[model samples]
Target: MSTPDPGDIEPPRDPRAAFAELSKIMLGEQPLSATLERVAQLAKQTIPGAADVSVTLLQDGEVASAAFTGPLAAQLDRQYEAGFGPCMDAATSGTTITIDDTAHSRRYPDFARAAARKGVRHTMSIGLPVQRQTIGALNLYGTDDVPFDEATQELATAFASYAAVAVANAGVYASTATLAANLQRALESRAVIDQAKGILMARHPGMSADAAFDLLSKQSQLSNRKLRDIAAELVDEVQRGGQD
Candidate 1:
């Protein structure tokens, strides 16, 4: 299949429509990475003079590009391997960092040189703030030396807000799904353990449920296995014997 170009996608000009598009992507069943990729593509399409766009995420105290429009955008983001690039700075400090002319930028000499060598003359990074905390950055690159105008910068900032909301909502949804799955597994394990306990009680007429559980626990410890696994094994063996 051919790769889809960001330029081919219709840009959402209105802020409300842009946010609705982002929300639709986030609310879908796709993974967070895919959603972030779509966000990057949307930003590239919406921002005028933007040659490329990337989403930089600070996960577990490490900064990395979570999504990008193309290889150039991803390469430029990684040029700051020392964790001192505009993208990293924006994400860490929760501020917008712009390099109007990469060749003349003194704030990040190394990154500027690298970006210039990669044909990127101007760049902007807007921090993605979620719930009073900065989680990432939205980075834009331009081949032209001209900096983004004030109005364009404002649009980028607004789009960053939408991206931040998408990230926050996606995180909450993922956490909720994980918790529900864990609870379901816990319930299933309890039911199986209870069945094993009943089997032990049936074998020993005077054994209480507590005693039966203790017996299973002892076997689990001696066998160097999980309590659940031990109970499952015993239950399976009894069922197979009954079938025979």
Candidate 2:
């Protein structure tokens, strides 16, 4: 699900508690998706008049929904499909977008219309600073007019500031995981190829290690298969022959 279930969200006792919880989430070992979902849920609990919350992330020049709470994802989807909204403007321009009442909003007529249809009366979008630039936005939606006061907006901004660092760290962790997997695969391929080469050398009199490897490479090229695959097949065939 795009948005987190309300039952999963724990209400914080106060702003201090909310900040502490957010810090814990940042330092936790949970994956990026879980961390982002928790951040959105916390935003809903921490901000007054916030019926829903969503995080819009911009990665590789593409905008995507990272996490959300309540039915906010559906509302954000309408804004994205229409190609313009407060959330989009917030991320792109590195500025805050706020509307006290969707019915009276003229800056984003289409977005206002869609949010009004969705029973959203007030909204706030704050840009998230990532490193040296703004890379995302934290969005809050209210069902009543003027749901967020100035204090609420300031608190949301502080949360977004810390969230930016957490998001960037998650990206780095994901990349490291992928690199580690690839390296492990490469090591396995090398070990199998070496074993196949040793088998070839032992089976043929006067055959050098390099010649055996060349033979395996030629077979791989002629069969249009991976070198690792050809090496594995040779090793299996040798084992079967020995057994017989």
Candidate 3:
């Protein structure tokens, strides 16, 4: 579903302003960690009562990276190791979970204690995916016990959705780059195989190149050896014959 239906809440009057900010982040040259740092910094700086923001990355069933600004950011690793925080559950569930008042909730005693000790009043988490698979979460903390109005929560989520796309796009681009490199390597290997067949054809004159290649293929299959290895041996034999 689109983050916020228009009927739910109209965006800021200068809707363009919010989008301009998002575009600037994607197009910027700074590293992604720097970009996430800026995202949190700007959110806390702009939003009323927002005390902190953090961007977390999960890969191979573990947290891979994280970036945050302010005191709350520093405490994230502790919560992760303790295994009792809203962000971890949200990342695993792939949903947004909110705790407006930690004191009353019976769930996650350890996290509640940590939040109380940290003076956290309210918190929210937005799950992000590297693709279809859940991989990370974005968390926001407020110092006052102010549950987000449905509208505010949605706007924040809309922005988080953008963050997820930015992260996933980087991953897809990297995977495609690796595939390109591998395909190039395979093409070069095939060229060598063709070169080996030519050498065999010349050594066994009157034999067609296709027929010579078949001989190598049959020998490789019968001996249960790799075709490349057999080709190498044939080339070596021709070289040794020349020396003799």
- The TM-score values for the models, in the order shown, are 0.64, 0.64, 0.58
Q: 1-244, model 1: which lDDT tens digit per residue?
A: 1122335535446666777887665454666666777888888778877888998776556676667776566446655446478898899888999999999998999888877766777889999998789988999988764688899899999889888988766656666565345335544665787899999999999998756776776676577666678889988999999999
| Model 3 root-mean-square deviation | 22.2
For residues 1-244, what per-residue lDDT tens digits would candidate 2 score against the true structure? Answer: 1222334444544767767776665433777666777878778787766777888776555555666664344334446645678888888877888988888788987787767756677789998887678877889887754557888788888888877777666655656564344335545666787899898898898998656766776676577676778899988998898899
What TM-score quantifies how close candidate 3 is to the native fold? Answer: 0.58
How good is model 1 by TM-score?
A: 0.64
Q: Which residue pairs in candidate 1 have backbone atoms (N, alpha carbon, C) closer than 3 angstroms, thus clashing?
A: none
Task: After the best TM-score superposition of candidate 3, give how far the Cα of residue 182 lies from its true spot, in angstroms.
Answer: 25
Error of 3 at 89 (Å): 1.5
Taking every candidate in turn, the Cα RMSD to the unseen true structure, in Å, is: 18.3, 18.2, 22.2
Question: Tens digits of per-residue lDDT for model 3 on 33-141?
Answer: 5555655555555444456677766655555225666434444334665554778877787788787876665676667665655567667877875457775777877
Query: RMSD of candidate 1 to the true fold?
Result: 18.3
On lDDT, the candidate that comes out on top is: 1
